[model samples]
Target: MDIHAWQLWILAAIIAGSLEMALPGFVMLWFCVGAVVASLAAAVGLDINVQLALFTLISVTLFAASRTLFKKAFMRNASTVKTGVEAMVGQEAVVTESLVEGYGGTVRINGELWSARPLGGPVAEGERVIVEQVEGLKLWVRRPAASLEVPLKKKEGR
Candidate 1:
């Protein structure tokens, strides 16, 4: 039985492709493409050195060229994609329990109760607070700023 160079290249390509599926980042796909190209070169009776050079050149060139495109396409909106606790920031919640100074209480947000600590003075029960930050299982909160409250206007004549 004779083992061929193209067979090894194809195996490498398959392994790289599998790795791309298992990994969390955009890599290994370029190497898989390069391996496939190297296998094609071997099928055309190209020298092993030439096949290796082609594989390295193709992989590196694709990796470098795609980096900027990947960043622009995927990372451009990264800041806008907030999830979990990060999305809780700036959200309004009703205090479920009086939050005493130097003591934490609970608040309800999004129909869920969360441990909350006041950012400044005490927050009374039923008061609306804005989530300022999240630390572990607790949320730092503050009374809604005056700007967020709408002032009632008096009638000119009653």
Candidate 2:
């Protein structure tokens, strides 16, 4: 049983395409395209060196040229969907334990309790604070601006 070079190239293309699907990011797609082009070159009676060279060139060119396009099209939109602790930023949490200045306490956000520290002054228990940043098992929080506003004075004698 004799196997042709083009058949091997097609197999490589299939494997690369499958790998691209299993992995994250747009990494292996260029190699899949390159293998397809190499297979076509082999079908046309091109020399082994020529087929290999074309595969390398096509893959590198597509990877480089499409990098920016892929980043703009795909990576840009991905930032809009944050996961894990990153999503906690800007969310309001009630202080479960009084947070001393420069010290950490507990806060409840999304039904989960988290160790938190104040970004400015200390936060009292039962006060609402906004998550500003997250640092390994701790959240930096600040009081909401509206809570700091002064109330209007009532008119003298009704």
- Per-candidate local distance difference test: 0.94, 0.93
Each model's RMSD to truth, in Å? 5.9, 6.3
Residue 20 lDDT (model 1): 95
> What pairs collide in candidate 2?
none
Give the deviation of candidate 2 from the true structure as CA RMSD: 6.3
User: Residue 19 of candidate 2: its Cα lDDT?
Assistant: 100
Candidate 2 lDDT at 129 equals 95
Question: Can you give the lDDT of residue 39 in candidate 1?
Answer: 99
Model 1, position 51, has a per-residue lDDT of 100
